[model samples]
Target: MSDSPHQMTPPPPEDEVSGWLRDRRGHFDQLVSSVEDYAIFMMSREGIILDWNRGAERLKGYTAPEIVGRHFSVFYSDEDRQSKFPDKELEIASAEGRFTVEGWRYRKDGTQFWASVTITAIRSESSAVEGFLKITRDLTEHRATDEMLRRSEERFRLLLESVQDYAIFMLDPEGHVMSWNNGARRIKLYEENEIVGRHFSIFYPPEAISIGMPGSLLAKALKDGRVEDEGWRVRKDGTRFWGNVVLTALHDSKGELRGFAKITRDLSDRQQVEHLRETGRRKDAFLATLAHELRNPLAPMLPGVDLLLHAPHDVATVTGIASMLKRQVDQMAHLIDDLLDMSRITAGKIALRHTVLPVREVVDTAVEASNPLIREFGHRLTLNLQDELMIEADPYRISQIISNLLSNAAKYTPPEGEIALTVSEKPGPMLEIRVTDNGIGIPKALQHSVFELFDQGASGSSGGLGIGLTLVRTLVEMHGGSIALFSAGEGQGCEFTVRLPVITTSAPAATGETPVIPSAPRSGPARILIADDGRNAADILGLFFQMEGMETAVAYDGEEAVKIAANFEPDFAFLDLGMPKLDGYEAARRIRRMYPRVILAALSGWGAEDDRRRSAEAGFDVHLLKPAKPDDLREVLRQHG
Candidate 1:
């Protein structure tokens, strides 16, 4: 009934105060001891350290007794302390209820340490002034690792940008160019913005696109993870080049393809080099075959003709042997000369010696040179020359060109066909020379490649190396002129016309009369030596010389000719070029070295200006082409003797 007289009375104030203090102390202990790495401490409302925990003692190198009651400003460096950062931090924390930052802080020993610090304004039940609870963790190693990783990424980006040889770029899933670098811009001629959203098929040529190569390449890359190809590619300007292209499909960790990476290289120069090398190889093989086959037939003709001319054979037999040897040897020699000339031209060694000459003289020489072949073919020829027509050109070479055209006309035309050489001077500053023939005209399709070396027309039946016209064009071009072929169609006959610019003529002297000569006359010949690789050519020339009553001997090469000079002791010597053991040039040198008095004359199939110059420098007094006329040979011998 008394209700426990002790319980009825209110609890004592002292007991209540003790219990509250105990509760607050328990909360502080739980908070400080539960910490793992952060240092936890208590400060007064004035920022003085009221308490320090084990974590604070271990991390800040401060014992409780040393840190207690000390101003929290001791955690700051001297500069920060002077700037009142610690006080400012406390004020901010109190105003905002909390403050957090990462900065450098000083330890008890004054060594600076990187720290992430959080300052909180501890509140009481009435929300009045209370101390601050600070939690801090060292952040030096983590910050260093992060900085190092950032630098490494920068280096990787720089490496990608510096590459220049390959056009490395990225594409979207649908094969759109997503990214381009400097190499891409240089190789594809597409700027970054211009190519960013364009389809990759723009790089393919029209022919490639017609065959669906672009789309097929993308599909192959998607299926196979990668695809590579080499072929012609197009640029922004519509120009084409050989390109090596590679496409690689890029994927993510989930095994789904993200996009593609494309790399391309310009291979135009490489393709050109490969093509030239292959062409050179083919040319070499063709020349070798031509040499072997052409040289075979001339072997028997040489000794046979030699024995017939020297033995006690009847005049008819000797004459017949001489004619066969001369015709066959002349044909074979022409083929060899063409091959050699083509070789020289391709090597860029053909040089021309230009001069001003009367066009009539050139035409006359061409006509006379082709007379034998014309008569053999039983073709009628007509010549029409303008009296004063003149041109600036290499006279001998121009003659050779005209003669080649005439002979070609004669060979291709039927018996009793008509061939005409007409010369006329244009009003301006050019002379026009035309050679027309009634023969099997060139087909229209062959005209495109008619001037190409070794493109023999319609193989087998028409026998020629297809070099004469090419040579004609080259020579005409060198003379600052042009040559063209005109034909109605095959079997409708063809005509070739050359137009050469003329040099202004000098004023004529006051001479009253012009000189003329009779056509029927023979120049006397003296002693001469004949040298040729084609024994048929050598024997034929020897027979011709014997008929002209000039002492002569046959030597197959330059070395033999040099030895023969000691016994024959001739006043003049004729030598052929391109012989075995030693060439005519070296033979000429050796002959001049042994017998400097002998007049060395070169009788060769090679007749280019450079060839003639080389002969002259090697001590040849004169250089003449193969299939030499008896009169020309006699004239050469007489001039030297």
Candidate 2:
């Protein structure tokens, strides 16, 4: 291929080049004129204004025809112009390529404004200085904002130092004290200079410092962003005070851990001591009364045993003694049950088992349980119930509530007294149950405390354990309901109204009663095992089952029960939860591994929901409280069958 000479393109004529340059300059001028925020113009090397745009005209309060050709010194302050500072700015920009400054400048009207100005030398290709391009921007609003923020910071510092209650301070990332307010000095009895370099652990007790509590707390706050604690804090005087402290982690804008901000409040001992004393007084009174009540039950039991020993052959005399003892035992059991319920309520350990139940069924159960006591007192009982009312409640607790009120009335009322129970619907999604008794009414002064724990208001000999009303109110509230007392006077009658939220007015499913299981022992697992730490309890239960024609074996502890299960492999096992030698839960787990299908029951005196949950976790099918009624035990067996 033949090589071709490189094609050469001729440059445009000077006239055409001048036209293109003019076009670009016109575009630049248009662009600079539209800018409103900045004053832009061209100035001579001598600091005289050579060109002006719309922005410069707007900023300087002069049109292009009026301000052009004027020296840029007009924008400077009088003192600056007198000092030749305007000329100095151009000279510096020409030598250094650019110069920038922020100061006060004047408009054509002679008003002053804060401004930021930059002057840049327009240089040729050989770097020779030409005219300068100046840009001026208004900064008045920004300066005002910065000044206001500075004043605000000063006020906040004063306020923090003036606070007298809370001890506010700052710490470095290493937990060394950095800043202290006046409140910190007052509360800790230490001057700022004395504590600024000290570790925050100085405020904690010696024991806390020995265990690295302060360092650990700082780490926790750093991790969790904030932490609150209350404990004894030491003062410089060596006295200790209970302080509630809050430590908040401070962070920078980049989310980096900066330090900590701490606030402490002194909860002085006087108020706490008074509260504790009142609590102790109530507890002491309850213990004394409990001792007396238990003694009353045991006192008659000893005499009854003597009577039984003397009248060994007389059936009538023995029956009377047995019945008397049974009543006393029942009374003691009732007292204990109430105490347990109250404990559960106060500890927030009780979880209600709610069911959609008809109010009539609950009322009927309560009335039946209370009839014997009512008949013994020769009291007239009346009931007024609305039909087809349903509620969501723990059925047992609901009945217990009514039974307690009824028993209280029977115990306090004179013979042949009248008691009334009325259940009616209300306007809202609520229903009301009222129990009234023509008994010694509550005194006016004591009405407010009638439902408090261990309250002795208007409670004479017939108060029972003095916690029935408290239990009633707690149970009612748990059902999302409320209870109130109404009394005319001491001589008149008293009424307790319990209002409960209703689930529905009528529903077929709710109206249907719970399935009835026979209380008599029925066909179930033939081979059974019973284990307990109490030999008498275990043997008696075994004997009772054997009498009912079931093969039964008894063990005194958990280890023996597991050994028996290894060979005997009973179809049903009732294990006392508090057994020695490995305990019931472990025994149940081992037995379950051997016979996964075997039914396990936890028999114990402690019947909290947590206990039941633990039993369930250990593979027990049921948890029965101590002194399990014959009827309850039979129902358990029937389910298995």
- Candidate 1 lDDT, 482-564, residue by residue in tens: 88888787887889898877544843334453332221233644567888889988897888789878877889987888789
Give candidate 2 regions above 4 Å deviation: 1-279, 305-325, 461-463, 506-525
RMSD (CA, Å), each prediction: 13.4, 20.3
**What lDDT does the true structure give each of the candidates?**
0.76, 0.82
Q: Give the best candidate by lDDT.
A: 2
Give lDDT tens digits, candidate 2, residues 1-641. 11111111122233433232323444446567567678887665666665566667667786665666678898888899899999899889998999999999999899988889999987765677656789998888998898799889889888988999989999999999998999999999999999998989989998888998998899899889999998889999999988999999999999988899999988877558965886677667778878888999899899889988988999998989878877787778788889888888888999998777788889999999889789998999999998688877788999999998898788878889999999898877778889999988988988977787776558654646678888998988888889988899897988999888855744534455445333234475467899999998999789878977778989999999999988886878999988888799999999989887787889988788998899999999889987765666777778774
Candidate 2 has its poorest 10 consecutive residues by lDDT at 1-10
Q: lDDT score of model 1?
A: 0.76
In candidate 1, position 244 carries an lDDT of 91
Model 1 stretches with alpha carbons more than 4 Å out: 1-312, 372-382, 411-420, 437-439, 458-461, 488-492, 507-570, 573-598, 602-620, 623-632
